[model samples]
Target: MPGPPRSRVSCAKCGEGVNDRREVISVLEKKLCRPCAAGGYYEPI
Candidate 1:
């Protein structure tokens, strides 16, 4: 068996991989990552 091909969507702000499909695109900027969009400045991982 195989899995679906990964979709490549770069972060609007950082130009990095979002890693997941964002159902709704942010309008403040372009496509922003979860953290960027959420404004999570320093959330402990």
Candidate 2:
């Protein structure tokens, strides 16, 4: 099945499109996918 189109802005960590997804991670004032912000290894804040 085809996903909901593709967008330019994607999550830096996850690589998923941050297009239609409302609940995106706005890190550094930028947009990111849910998984990118929530999952993955952590370094520091």
Candidate 3:
């Protein structure tokens, strides 16, 4: 059987269009792409 449906969402940092099934990371309630998410751009303001 197939998994859940994938939703289209843009990366909160880079604004890249990606599917939910992709390797995305959520930080502070925001969805980010792998590159941006791993880039350590989440610096406290």
Candidate 4:
């Protein structure tokens, strides 16, 4: 079965695609991805 419909959004800083399933952060009235919201990318383990 297919998953839920995607509601794609763009991050204010990087313009990365964000979907409804992923976590979205709002800052200063702009939508941001997790990395952007966290102020940087995560280091790989």
Predicted candidate 2 versus true structure: per-residue lDDT over 1-45, tens digit per residue? 267645457666557665655446564776777666676566558
- lDDT of candidate model 2 versus the reference: 0.61
Select the stronger candidate by TM-score from 3 and 4: 4
Q: Which digits, one per residue and each the tens of the lDDT, describe model 3 over residues 1-45?
A: 267546777888879877655746675878887778777656659
Q: What value of lDDT does candidate 1 attain over all alpha carbons?
A: 0.67
User: Using alpha carbons, what is the TM-score of model 1?
Assistant: 0.56
The 10-residue segment with the lowest total lDDT in model 1: 16-25
lDDT-based ranking: 4, 3, 1, 2
Candidate 2 stretches with Cα past 4 Å from truth are: 1-8, 40-45
Query: Which portions of model 3 miss their true places by more than 4 Å?
Result: 1-5, 40-45
lDDT of each: 0.67, 0.61, 0.72, 0.74
Q: List the residue pairs that clash in candidate 4.
A: none
Question: Which regions of candidate 4 fall more than 4 Å away from where they truly are?
Answer: 1-4, 21-23, 40-45
Candidate 1 structure quality by residue, lDDT tens digits, 1-45 = 157536658887777676547523687647877777777678667
RMSD of each: 4.1, 5.4, 7.3, 3.9
Ten-residue stretch with the least lDDT total in model 2: 18-27
lDDT of 4 by residue, 1-45 (tens): 278656878888889988874656575677888888876655659
TM-score of each: 0.56, 0.41, 0.55, 0.60
Model 2, C-alpha of 44: deviation from truth (Å) = 19
Best by TM-score: 4
